[model samples]
Target: MRENREIAHTFDTLADLLEIEGANPFRVRAYRNAARVVDSISQNVAMMVREGRDLSQYPGIGKDLAGKIRTVSETGTLPLLEEVEKRVPRALSELTQIEGLGPRRVKALHESLQVNSLEDLEKAVDQGRVRELPGFGARTEELVRNGLKRLRGTQGRTLIADAEETAVHLERFLSGLQGVKQVTVAGSYRRRRETVGDLDVLVTCRPGVPVGKWFTSFESVETILSQGETRSSVRLRSGLQVDLRVVPEISYGAALHYFTGSKAHNIAIRKLGMARGLRINEYGVFSGDQRIAGRTEAEVFAAVDLPFIEPELREDRGEVDAARNGRLPELIRIEDIRGDLHAHTNATDGRSGLESMVDAARERGYEYLAITDHSQAVTVAKGLDVERLRKQLQAIDRLQEQYDDIRILKGSEVDILEDGRLDLPDEILRELDITVCSVHSRFNLPEAQQTERILRAMDNPHFRILGHPSGRLLNKRDPYPMDLERIITGAVERGRFLEVNAQPDRLDLTDTACQLAKEKGAKLAISTDAHSDSGLAGIRFGIGQARRGWLEKQDVINTRPLPELLKLLRNT
Candidate 1:
């Protein structure tokens, strides 16, 4: 069965390749739109195919696209993609992966420098050839070089979302096995880490059941590295490694606890057990040859006189003490969020238009949605100029009149220039309901300079949230040099806020940073920075980061109702 993400990726790559080939703009857009639809649909594409439903019924998907989707679902391959691959080298498609290199920039590079591969592009940059390009300057060249280095550093691991999708499919398949009783995906997947190295799946089955054999039957399994009666390991076509183990029902919970661990957390638990003359392992807990607790995670915790800890908090970060003292934070949940403050529209780089974005926010049950499109500094996004922003604000004012259920606020994700000035004028910024200032350029500034630059931006009374404060992309770029602690402290003193950007690629304000914000009594907003309505789903990743940071509902600014949230925003 084809995963939704895999099919979506195929479509996205096809669209990018077509764009590089200078295909029709409408044709390229059709594939891109279809990719978004496939990626964001609530249900699995495999399930839809299995049920024989019409995939063309979905937005942007036509009969031809539907047939291609069916082919991918049934055959695990798309013929069009195969045909396209023959003409376009895989390296050319990959060139577009670098940050700031859109299809147009990529096309420019290929045409000007004959750089079809990462190595070729890197050599060109080393020779000082990229900086001389028409659109790409010294800054863009440096950014691309850094992006390539980061990509190489984190090549094999998959995003947590991708791993979870695989786990969901595999778990469903195993649950359907005749003799299997329970299927639990342990390891980092269960803990909701931002990136997962591998998956460890624990299954409980009736005696004499051959569950391990059934596991290898998964269609996505690319190669069986090892197989045994009780255990098996395989690599999926997506390059994710998966291991399956069959545990006795009595030890299922213990196995889950043992495998779903940060080694440090597990060591702490083992030490705590040792102090009490209790032996703990993947088997049942033991006290002087007597089995005590192992059937449930709560039971395992209770055996050591500790409270059950959420998987997200299983990182030995004072969680042990918190659990022991019954002081574990009640982490924020997805339902606690009341609105999204930083979102975009087709007026900028966002794929969807204003009305469509608002409708998507409505679907999420948001009490408020802010149109925080990029400001004038970010030309690549066609960031809004003064006149365009005024028109957008007026349009937002009009849209607000039509919907009494949700408040639509006019906002801009304005840029924080290198000189510590905001991209949009304070006069225009104050007119909006809120202003989200971010650093779009000069990410390589020194620590002291960067800190001062942001502090000066925060000096503006209109500036509310600091968007993706560190400017780091997970597995793609290290955060720019800045004293984050001082910055967080400054935010508190100035009544400014930090954002936990929800985009998977940019889960900035890491878990530790979120906790720091909470400790300083500065609120944080978990925004999708969504470029499309479908991008709203990225909020889950943000919530995961928040929970891991031990954030509670009150710690997040958006958790409050509209009126209260508005008051908070105003005061801050």
Candidate 2:
């Protein structure tokens, strides 16, 4: 590690600890100084450790700082992490993710105003107390309000979807650089969280021209927070910050694994590394007194006696055991899905006509796609009545004829009204290709009532697919209170498919629920419920959630071919 990178990391870690313990500046600076020592060392820290050098021997790392380094090296975590967690509300870090808030303001608010949680902050703004604080005014308060509003309705915390595109763009750009051998987008974004705070990119480039030439070429840079030989930080045009670090090609994979983290997952792996007499960090892998492997992720894991983990499974959710035991679920793959069984058209609230949607589905090589427009009750979605639905079915028949390879299954996304009944009449439901059922309204029911309502709706002979069973939008909204286990079990017994909605905003029957449903013998369906032709791409999100939940091809009902799906539909 270069001295500068080490210093930067120390500052980064200090930032967390400072925020956690409300530590005053100087104490935090000690840790920052130690981080600088590690980051800036031209000689490997592993080599230093091998020489039996005590970190205490290094300046800036006093007895206390040395202890932290020892803990970090041995545990892959700070021993004080839990203590820090206790001192500060874990959510203070989250509050920082809101636009326009930083550590200084967060500390000021916490100390002076007792605003620690997002809810508390929201309340403070609503009560007009925040605008009264030093360095804050009505404009800042408005930004805070908008920040809360933007963050409030998310399904989970992650880099924005648009940020992902930016990351891909950066990856391609850096990879194309003359001196670059490899580049990767890492951090929380790689883990697919619903929102992100910043971007981390690792670059491995050939040794030749200095980093300055490469760094200067980025004209989109808003501000260069820092620039050095091995690492740099810059604010981008989109108001997002990007930090790039250059490493040797040999360490690219290990560096990526080290940086791409959920923190918890990395800590667990580090523990594993320690138990095996190995040290793991962004610098790569080391056995006591020896450099082992740092060339690839496979090599790093092999050094630790584990299989390489996929990015999606890096959520610290029992992946280690799954890898150790070789029972990682065969996870649903994109190709296994042969058709989309729920959709809508301009005949309802959808933007495209039936013909265009079916044509798009055919273009994707789907053998069958359902045109399940909204039923009459969902007026906001322009839901249709039986008479209009009859005309929509005729259009489906014509589209099916127009494209022989694509079969448009007549269907309707019937609303499960407040009283536990389908909005469409039984005759209309029976007339459709498939009757997909869901409760889009009445989310305020008690858990028991919600469970009963859904069970009763699933019992309808016409009901085939249960969409987004919990009606959650990840971080944005809480799931409608319901007894999930009972709902899944009853659906299993009744032989109805639980939908794994692919919409990014609503990957409901979340991976956890889908896993449970599969465990309970309930079948699962991956439906895009695409209201527009472009929205059809949402299946990709569903597949990601399914993979996270350990779903396999056989666990998903929609993975079946057209004939098999038709057989199941007819049986329903």
Candidate 3:
């Protein structure tokens, strides 16, 4: 069965190819928009198709696009995509996957120098021919080369969001099996890493149950790599490999601990067990072949005289020592979030209207929701000008009167210009409840200049938080050159905050960066940067990232109640 992401990828590829072929602008945008709508939706599109439901009712998916979605879900390939691939080399679409190479640039390269693939692009770069093209300079060529390197480095890893979708589906399926008693997805996935290389599933079942065989026969299984009574591995249609293992009920805890690990953390735990004249392995902790403890993770930890550590903290980054001293952090949870600080509506590129967004926030039991639409710098998103933004503020006031349950704060995702000035003037910024200043373009500035640029932006009294601070799109664009330590320190000095953007593709302020911010006594706001109501749920991903970085509820500003949060914003 095709996943929503697979279907979305199909439409995106078709759109990219159409654009490279200079097809109608509307035609290309329709497919691109359809892809966004499909990917962002939480529903199982393939199931919807099987049930004969209408996909056309979804946003950006009209009757024609709905038919294409059904065809791809049923047959695993889009006919239109095949037709387009024949006319334009499919490799060109892949070229667009490289950063700094949009459809227009790819077309220009193809038409001028016949650069059809990565290999051709490499050759052109090597011969210094690419820089001689109309818009390609030495700097642009260097960026392309670096982007290619980054792309290859992250080639096979799946984003955590995509991996979670697959893992959840499988876990639900396996839990329903008659004899299965426990199922857990281990490894970096359990750790909530930003990217997952593969999945490790541990299960406990009855002796006669054929769990491995059932796993290999899952509907989404693309290839059965190996199959057996106790263990099996299969490749899903999304190209993610999964390994399932069956362990005894007595050793389920030990197996889960062993599989869900960083190698260093496991080694440290094993050494601790050894000090007590015991041997530790997946089976259990044994003292001369007689099992001591293993029935639960807590039992295993107690054997070593340490409290059970959270999976996100099992990275051996002082966690073992912290556990020994009882200093483990009380990590932040999704429920601790009082409200979302950054969100957009139809006023910008967001899908829902203001009233609908307010209703969604109220349904979630939030005290406040900031309407931070894009400013004028991002013209592609139809960013608002001064007059338009003032109009939005007036509208927020009117909408606020209708809802006492949720306070709708006025805000804007203002653009931080390349030269350290803001896109919108200070007078207008002061009238708003909040400002999430961000760097939307010129991501290639040198380290000193970029650092200075943001530092200067932080000097503004109205600049509340640094949005997507690193400006990286995972597995696609690299973070621009900047001194993160200095930036964090600057934020601390200026009483500003850093945004842990919860968007799946741009979970900026990485786990390590989050840790660094905490070390520097800087605060963070885990906002969804949501473009639609469904996008609001992305806060879970940010929470996972925060836990991995050892953040607690007190360390996050938005976790505070509305009055305290407003005071903090005002102080800034």
Clashes of each: 0, 22, 0
Score every model by TM-score.
Answer: 0.90, 0.72, 0.98
Q: Where does the lowest 10-residue lDDT sum fall in candidate 3?
A: 91-100
Worst 10 residues of 2 by lDDT: 1-10
Cand. 2 Cα-lDDT: 0.75
- For candidate 3, lDDT tens digit of each residue in 1-572? 67889999999989999999999999999999988888888788898999999998877788999999899889989888999988888888888978878999999998898988888988988898888988889988987888788878998799999999999989999999999999999999999999999999999998899999889989999899999999899999888999999999899888888999988898999999999998988898999989998878888888999999999999889999999999999999999999999999988899888888888888889999999999999999999999999999999999898988889989999999999999999889999999999999998889999999999999988999999999999999989999999999999999999999988888889999999999899999999998888888889999999999999999999999999999999998
Q: Any idea what lDDT model 3 has? A: 0.92
lDDT of 2 by residue, 1-572 (tens): 11223323434555554755568777766665566456534344543554667777554667777666655554345546556766776678667656558777887788889987888998999999989998999888886887788787552344344465567667766776787777788887776654577888888777774654466356456688888888888876555688888888777778888888878888888898999989988878888767688888888888878988877778788888889999777767888888898888878766667777787788778888888888899997788998988887876676667667777788888999988899988887788768789898977688899999999998899889898888966444567899999888888788888898876667787766776887788888898888777667668777877877778899887788888888888886
Which candidate would rank higher by lDDT, 2 or 3? 3
Ranking by TM-score: 3, 1, 2
Alpha-carbon shift of residue 388 in model 2 (angstroms): 0.7
Residue pairs with clashing backbones, model 1: none
Clashing pairs in 3: none
